[model samples]
Target: MVISSDSQRDLFSDTGALGFVQILLAEMHDDLLGKVARFRQLTDLSKTLGPGGTMIHGGEVAYTAWTEARNSFIHGNYIATVMLCQSLAENLLAAYIDTDLEAEKLPKRVSFNDTIRRCVSKGVFDKSFSGELITMMNIRNPLSHYRDLEDPSNLSRRVLDSRLPAIAHLMGDASFALAIAIKLLSLPPFWLSGETLK
Candidate 1:
């Protein structure tokens, strides 16, 4: 059967409820496809610098955790992502420091603060970078612990409220945490040999 021009035009026109619904669904599908494409790009970027290439001990685990943390942040799990990034920084710093210390001489356990101090003392990181890492830790600790507090009036909870301004502040802190994590991972002194550094 030969379809008339008017019939073909009517088929694609968004003039009725059904047409509106169909148009909405098509727009939603396009948006989802765009998101999926972006997600794939991020995943590829995350794997660009592999753990082995970084050369820190336990680098593999830390790199994997970083990728997961990045995914979490992209997926809107900001608080969890910040916490994971902070943990990754700690692990990377510890492993980097342990590289220079004898196995027997290493501490049984070290806190993040102690690890940062050791890194600074060993020249793995300078005082300024050490201070930045400490600041990131400070931001992560309060946010992470605030979720576990039982008291509704806790200072951390009050400061990190659900309001827009508070959320923006948390996002800023998370960005700093991620930036510090990446800096620690890619620091030339940590990854380079003596000859390379010189």
Candidate 2:
């Protein structure tokens, strides 16, 4: 994504604004680098674990979704970013569950809330971590449904408190959610030999 020449000039015309934008851009760049590094680590870990064919495919899908989510966040599509993050989380949770149980044993289609609840009940994730996933999913709802903004039931207090107010805040929230998704996805299943999965 190249910044347009006009936009670049506008940013540079104001000394203070330029400084602030530069700082934000630098931080975003660093975050992208960190994500790349962690992705490489996850790839190496997957290789060592020698996950099955199904796991390998699921990892690829989850990674692709994660990358798209990051790009969306960078482009300031906050709602799309949040939605993609939620999808990534669901994909990871489903992959983990499938690793231990047969596909037929699971629900045909699981919602994000159901996925988190199932994972927590099965001990695949801790209650607190699952709570965070739930929080993230809750935040996605308002962005996903326009009417949710008017419905008090769909709006979450925590999300309202940490709502994206600016580019920096949006990036920060998206980055944090993406980080959580990546961490969960990178956790190799316990069934894999050689390393004991936490």
Candidate 3:
């Protein structure tokens, strides 16, 4: 799929925002301002990637919904915002499964990273792609389950650094985790092909 690099607005990195979570949440909702359009973009990708008639998981759609609700939460949409955290968690895994089905041949059972690795092992993606997916998938757990925001060592940064080199500026932030999550879905399988995953 041909995607426009400029389609996603850089809300957190460009706005000079202070709070990572608050700013990112706000940016997702500010479609008119063009601060960032990650929610819209990811949703579109999820649909496009599943064009083959396979049933895409609700979790994938929920994750995109959580991203949208996060913005609404900032604007006092309490009902929607209250549930985004958990919804996002479910979505992440769902999206992973959707990616699994995209493969020409799929394994019977595997985790999100392993599923991606299987694709790489088939020469669909290079070994480095598996490593990156593993790192990002590993990080998603802490990001989804953690409660304290004060701690600087969060998984989102590690995942982002693995994908987007520019995110190195804020490697300890959890809010950007969603951005990384969506980024994982955005990348094409072709870009990751070449090396063995092991």
Candidate 4:
């Protein structure tokens, strides 16, 4: 059954849905007492960000991006995972550069690329790491915007439009996206900066 995009199906689709879910749950149940999961770092941001009252408003985006990105990865929404990771990195850099590290308005017309450049200039991240951030943008670019199929760098052609299988490419890219998010979230300046600038 193909549900149309406009369709609004109830969460409880049918009476048997609950029974099916219960069976699936039992199948997935793990008896292990301890299992270190890869999803932990990508799940929370408020703890890392600290006492609330952002550098500017809307810092909460970073929190949501992490959760959604993790969900996207685990659910096989690889494209969304890649895109959200890039967005998370950009927002973090913007937070650091917004209003001289104070709770002031972010400057006007600062592009995402410029936000990264500013972070490097302010010594927020070294020149080497600047390339890492840029790499995030590059990976996300094809997903975010249209790319010519003739171009060798077009990710859609490489991942979706191909006659051959591209699942491995997509899975690898999503994993790489998570790795980038983990590194950015773990950065001292980002996690320790908190909401206030002192």
Candidate 5:
């Protein structure tokens, strides 16, 4: 029986989904563990955390999301894809700041505008730096789902149109999500500025 392209795509896509997660996990493995260890070192060195630190809490949350995503993917649970995508997004965002750092130091919200603004405040990114993170989230959402979108390519194109240039500027012609993740990792939580800046 000849497999329709859609069916072929579905099979291929499911495989790709797993591959994407695996690659993401691999790329993040050292970084994530290193960050956790570093956070402990920073806390020990500073001796300045108050009774409550969102960074510590955020680390726990990131770990929880990671576990759920990992378990779902390993068990072949359908929702694993979505959970993993969200986990990736959340961890990427959390990595933008010191997990043990103060929350007030960050913007009250997590928007593209807020991220850029915060970066500028830190003297890292300039105000002219701009991109639409929400748009990328939409693209990620559908890709994480099993239902066929009306026009996946169109959606992908739209995200590319909005975010590709900014991404290329940062990561040299990478996908928007990757660019964002790279930028996030390079910043406070990972603090491997010199390594990733180039």
Candidate 6:
């Protein structure tokens, strides 16, 4: 990861000028923070997930992923931001279920969809919010799972204007991901002002 003159030389020698140019193409764009047109849709999201309060649980891994998701969105890595946001949601719900349910009552951690169902059934969150989480989950499934040509969710078959780029969709998806994450964090045991679960 350490960059040096030798590495630069090697990169140029291995890929030639064309490949080197391609590698930096995405990183050389306009200020990504400024490109985020949808972030202004919810300015108050900061009041929820911003760096003012302490997280109540011991899920550092999830928190780190959430941080990286935010970083990715700000830095123009929209695909990574969307995927990581879904991942953070899945992990956060799992962490809550592990803590709230008894060992005998719990089954395998299983799938994110299943986890969401269990959480709703157990009163972890209501159906309305679960619908939002489900949308996040569905958005991610198309990215991870390969689909046939007829599947609209398949990236290869998705409808788009011929002039538009994939990043256009990804930018919107990443923005929605961040908003959904804020909604999740703003709910229940995660966002108690001074109240503790008994």
- lDDT of the candidates, in the order given: 0.69, 0.64, 0.45, 0.67, 0.45, 0.74
Best by TM-score: 6
Tens digits of per-residue lDDT for model 2, 29-125: 8767655754554355335333432232348777788778766755556567777888888887777676675433557787777777777788777
| Residue range with the least summed lDDT across 10 consecutive positions in model 2 | 48-57
- Candidate 1 residues 57-101, lDDT tens each? 556777777877777665546677778888798787787777764
In Å, residue 194's CA in model 6 sits off its true spot by 6.4
Better of 3 and 6 by TM-score: 6
Query: What's the TM-score of each model vs. the native?
Result: 0.61, 0.55, 0.34, 0.65, 0.33, 0.72
Scored by lDDT, model 4 comes in at 0.67
Per-residue lDDT of 39 in model 4: 44
Q: Evaluate model 5: give its TM-score.
A: 0.33
What local lDDT does model 2 show for residue 53? 22
Model 5 ranges with Cα > 4 A deviation: 1-57, 91-104, 116-138, 143-149, 153-198
- lDDT tens per residue, model 4, 1-198: 987655745643555878898977774464222112434434543344324323322278877887788777766678889988887877767866774744445566567877877777777778887788787788788777887987665864775556545666766777788887776666656544334456
Off by over 4 Å in 1: 1-53, 101-104, 147-164, 192-198
lDDT winner: 6
Q: For residues 1-198, write the lDDT of model 3, one tens digit per residue.
A: 755657555422563446777878775566453323433543554453322322213445664665565465334343333244335434444354456645554345434555555556656457775565555444444544673444443434544546644233223222333344334444453133335569
Show where candidate 3 strays beyond 4 Å: 1-109, 145-183, 189-198
Between candidates 2 and 5, the one scoring higher on lDDT is 2
TM-score between model 2 and native? 0.55
Ranking by TM-score: 6, 4, 1, 2, 3, 5
